[model samples]
Target chain A: MTLVTVDDVRGAATRIASDVIRTPLLPCARLSDELGLRVLIKPESLQNTGSFKVRGALNTLLTWKENGTLPEGVVGFSAGNHAAAVAFAGQRLGVKAIIAMPHDAVESKVINVRRYGGEIVPTDDLLGTTEELASRYGYPPLLPFNLPEVIAGQGTVGLEIAEDAPEAAAVIVPVGGGGLISGIGAAVTALAPSMRVIGVEPEISNALSLAMTHGEVRELPRAERTIADGLAAPRAGNHTLENALAYVDEMAVVSENAIGEAWADLADSAKLIVEPAAAVGLAALRTGAVSLPAGCTVVLVVSGGNADLVKLAQARMG
Target chain B: MTLVTVDDVRGAATRIASDVIRTPLLPCARLSDELGLRVLIKPESLQNTGSFKVRGALNTLLTWKENGTLPEGVVGFSAGNHAAAVAFAGQRLGVKAIIAMPHDAVESKVINVRRYGGEIVPTDDLLGTTEELASRYGYPPLLPFNLPEVIAGQGTVGLEIAEDAPEAAAVIVPVGGGGLISGIGAAVTALAPSMRVIGVEPEISNALSLAMTHGEVRELPRAERTIADGLAAPRAGNHTLENALAYVDEMAVVSENAIGEAWADLADSAKLIVEPAAAVGLAALRTGAVSLPAGCTVVLVVSGGNADLVKLAQARMG
Candidate 1:
C-alpha cells in the first residue's frame, strides 16, 4: 500500500503552489473571546474552484502529465465541488473531462462544472455510470479521495496549518469520504505530533466514525440524508481508513440543527458564508462534542463554501 | 488645504500593515469568462472588522498616537461597519470608544460593534447626538469619512489595487460618503494615470453623482430608503467632492433590483456574501450601467460584508 508521507505533502505544496491559492488563516476574534480558546480559521472555501478539491484534482492531473501517461480524457463522479475541480483542472491541463453526477445534484454545481468545460453525464447511479464511461471511453478514472496522489495533495492543508499555527493544541477537520481528515491527520501527526487531530461528520453520515469503531473500512447499512451533502459519503475509502487509524486522535459527530446554528454563527460573527459541510468542525466545537484544554489555540479547517443560496439563507435563519 | 498625497497613503499602509489584513485580489473566473473582461475582486469584506473601514480607523488612531494628541476617549457616529472599526481600533489602541448609532440599525452590526468593546449610545440623530456627547465629555470625535487623515487612510486601497493590477483599464468602487472612491482616485491616478476610476451608488442615494454634475458638494432633497443601508449617507463630504472632481472619471447609479441580483450572483458564483452597498459596483457592471471596453482588466473593490441574514436570503431569492 502506498501511504501519503510528510514529504509527499511538501512536494505537492511545491507542485501546486502556482495553481492553487494559499488561502488565508484568519483569527476569529469574537469566537476566541467567547470560547476562551484562540480560534484560527483556514478558509479553503476561498480556494480556486471554491474548495480544497482543486488541490487534489490539480495534483493528480499534474502527476499524470509529468509521467507522460496523461490520458486523452478523465472521468469522475461527484455531487459538486470535486466535479468542478476535476473539470477546471482538466481544462487548464489541456485534457478533456466527462463528469458523472446525480440528476438531483445542486443546480449551481452543475453549472460550475459546465462552466469549466466539463461534459456532464447525469445518472441515477453516479459511481456505476462513471466507471462504465471510463471503461467505454478508455479514460482514466479520478476517484475523489481514494487515491494516493489525491490524499497527499489534500494533506497540504495540514502542512499549512502546522506552519501557520504551530502552537495550536487541537485541529478540527470536517470529514467527507474521509479524504480530508486522513490527509490532515497524516500531515499534522508528522509535523506536530503532540497536537490533537479530530474529525467531524454529520450524525446521519458517520462513515469515518463507524469505520474507526469497526477497525476497517465498511459501508453503512443505509445511505442517510444530510444537509451537508458533501459529507454524505456512504463508505470510507480503504486508503483513507489506513491513514486515519495511524494518525487521527479522535472523531466526533454533530446534528443537522447544530450544523445550521454553527453556519449562522460563522455568517454573522466571522462574516463568512461557508457550506453546511464546512461548518461541521465549528458545529463539533460549538456543541461541545469535541473538547480541548481551556485557552488552547485551536484551528478549524473550513473545507468548502458551496451551497444553494436558499439553503444558506435557511441555515442562517436557524 | 492639506490634500491627500501618494506619500500619505504609503505612510498609512506602513502604519497599519501589522494590524490590518492585506486582503486578496482574487480573479473572478466565471465573471471574466462571461463578461469577456478580466475581472479582479478585492474582497475588503474579509478585512479586519469585516470592512475597509478599519484601514482608515486605524490610520486615524495611529496618527493621533504619533502626534501625542491621542485622547483617552473617542466618539464617533456610524450606522454599521465604521462603528465596529472604531470600536476595534479603540480597544487595540487602549482608548475608550463611544459610538452613537440609530436605534434602527442592523442587529448584527450593533452586536459586532459591542463585540469590539465599543459602548453603543442609541440615538435618533446619529451625527447630532455623537457631536453633543463628544463636546459634553470633552472627547475627540473621529469623523467617519470627511477628514484629510481619513481620506488618506482610505487611499491605501487604491495603492493595493494599482500594485496588484497595474494593467487594469478601469476600477469600480462603491460610493457611500465618497471617502473610499476619493482615496482610490488619488492613489490610482498617482500610480496608474491611464486607469479610469468610476464610482457607483444606489439610484436613490446618488449624492456623489449629483455633486459631480453640479461641480460641488450637495445634499439630497430628502433621505431615500434603500436596501443598501451603508450608502444612505445624506450628502457627499466636501473634501471627497474635491478629490472626485480631480481624479474620478465618471459616476454611475444602480437600482435596488440590480443591487439584489448582483448580491445573488456574488453569493452563488463568487461565494461571497457581501452587503448591498458592496454589491453596487457589481450591480453597475451586471446591468451595464457603467460600461467598460471589452477585454480590459477591471477591478471591483468589494467594500463590506455586513447584512441581515433574512435580507440576504431574500436578495438571493430575487
Candidate 2:
C-alpha cells in the first residue's frame, strides 16, 4: 500500500482552497494558561458543512472528476456531517448526489442536505444496518471511510497544521471511522517526524483504540451512545486502521458528560458553537486523558458544528 | 466632529489585523433567489465577542491607548456580548475590566464575561438605570454609542463590506443604541455613497426609528418585550440619533415574532447559531418592512451571536 504523502496533501490543499474555508488557528489563552502549554485550535467547526468532512469529500470527488473516474452520480450513506459534506461536495463540483440517511437522523441535517440539492433516501429502521440501504440505492455507494482518496484528502488538515505550527509537539483529532485521524496522522508523521499524533474518541465508541490494541480492525458489538454522534463509530475501517496503527502516537476516550461539558466550556469561553465530537479532544485534555509536556504546543482539531439543536437545548437545560 | 473618513476606516482594518477575524462575506443564494435580488451576509455573529461590538469596543480602546488617553482600567455596562467584548478588549490590552450587568442578564452571558477574565457585578434591579453601578466601580464606562471612536471603529465592518462587495446596492444593519448603524452608515455612505444604508430594529424597542420621527432621544415608559435583548435599548444616545438622522438611508422595525423566526430560519438553513438581533435585519426583509431595490445586491450585517440558551430553547420548542 502506498501511504499518502505530504505532496498529495499539499495538492489537496490547493485543490480545495477556493471552496473550503481555511479555518483559523486560534490561540486558546485560557486553555494554554491552564495546561501550562501553548494551545492552538483548528476551527474546522467553521467549515462549509460545519465539519472537516467537507475537505475529504470535496477532495475525493474533485480528484475523481479530474482523473475521469467519477460516475454519472455519487451515492453515500451517513447519518450526519458526511452526508451533508457529500451533498455540498456534489453541488459545488456539479455532480449529482444520492444520500442514504438513517430514519432518525436529525431533521436539521436532513434538511441541510436537501437544501444543498442532494437526493435523500431514508431507511425505515436504523438497527446498525447500512449495507441494505446502500444496496437499495441501485447505482454506486460512496463510503466515507474505506476510500483511498478520502484518506489522502483528509491528510491535508494535518499538512496544514504542520506548516502553520511546525513547532507543535502534538496534534489531537477526534476519531470516527478513523478517516480523519488516519489522514492527519499520516501528514504529521511524514512532515514533522517529531510531532506526535493523538486520536480522541468517545468512551462509548472506542473502536479504533480497541483495534489498535488488538492489532486489527475490530467491531464493537454495541454502538456507544454519545452526544458527539459524529465520533461514535462502531467499527474501524481497514485502511484507516492500518494508517492509525502505523502513525498515531496515542489514543484517548472521553465520556458523554465530559464531551457535553467541553462543548459548554468552549461556547462559554471561546464564544464558539462546536458539536460534541469537535470538543472531544479538549474534553480528553480537560479530563487528563493526555498530559502535555511543559511548554509543548498542541493543536486540537475542532471537527465540525452541524449540531442537533434539540440535543444542544437539552444539554443546556440540564 | 470630523466624520470618519475612508482612510481612518482603512487604518482600523490594519490596526485590528492580527486581533480580529476577517469573517467571510457569505453569499445567500436561496435568500437571494427568494427575494429576486442578490443577498450577501457579513456574519459578524461569528466575531470574537459573538458580535461586531468587539470591533468598535476594541478599536475605541486601542485608538485611545494609541492617542495616549486610555486610563489604567476600563469598565462597561452590557447585557452580555459587550461585557464580554470589554473583557476581551481589556485582556488583550492588559487592563482590568469590571462589567455592570442587570441581575436578570442571561446566565450564559454573565458566565462568558467572567470566563474571559473580567469581573462582573450584578445589579440589584433589572431596571434601566446603570449610572450608579458605573460610578460605584470607579470605572469610566465604555459606551456602545455616544462615543465617536466607537462609532468609527464599528464603521470598519461597513468598510469591509464596501471593499469586499463594491457592487452591493444596499447594506442592512440592526440598530440598538445605533453605534453599529452609526459606524456602518458612515463607512458605507463614504465608501459606497450609491449604496443605500438601511437600519433595522425590533418594533418593541425601536428607539432609533421613533427618535428619528420625534427628532430626539426619548425614553419609553415601558421596555417592549422581545427575544432580541441585545437590541432592546431603552433610549437612543444623542450621538447615535444624530448619526442615524444624517447617515441612515432608511429605518424599519420588525416584530418580536419576526426576530425569532429569522433566528430559526438561519439556523435551519445556514446551520448557524445567530442571536436575535443579528436576525432582525433578515426579519425586516422577510416581514416586508424593508424592500430591496430592483436587481440590487444587498448586504446584511449579522451583528452578534449572544443568544440566551433559554430563549433559544423556548423558540425551538414552540
Candidate achieving the largest DockQ: 1
Off by over 4 Å in 1: A10-18, A94-96, A119-124, A135-138, A162-169, A186-196, A293-296, B94-96, B119-124, B162-167, B191-195, B293-296
Q: Model 2: which residue pairs collide?
A: none
lDDT string for model 2 (B142-205, tens) is: 8866787778778889988988898898999989889888888888888889999999988888
lDDT of 1 at B75: 97
True contacts kept of each: 0.51, 0.16
Model 2: DockQ score? 0.26
Identify the runs in model 2 with alpha carbons over 4 angstroms from their true place. A13-19, A26-40, A90-100, A116-138, A159-169, A187-195, A293-297, B7-41, B59-75, B87-100, B116-130, B133-139, B162-167, B192-195, B220-223, B293-298
- The number of clashing residue pairs in each candidate reads 0, 0
Question: Looking at candidate 2, what is the lDDT of residue A224?
Answer: 41
Highest TM-score scorer: 1
Q: TM-score of each candidate?
A: 0.90, 0.86
- Candidate whose lDDT is highest: 1
Q: Which pairs clash inside model 1?
A: none
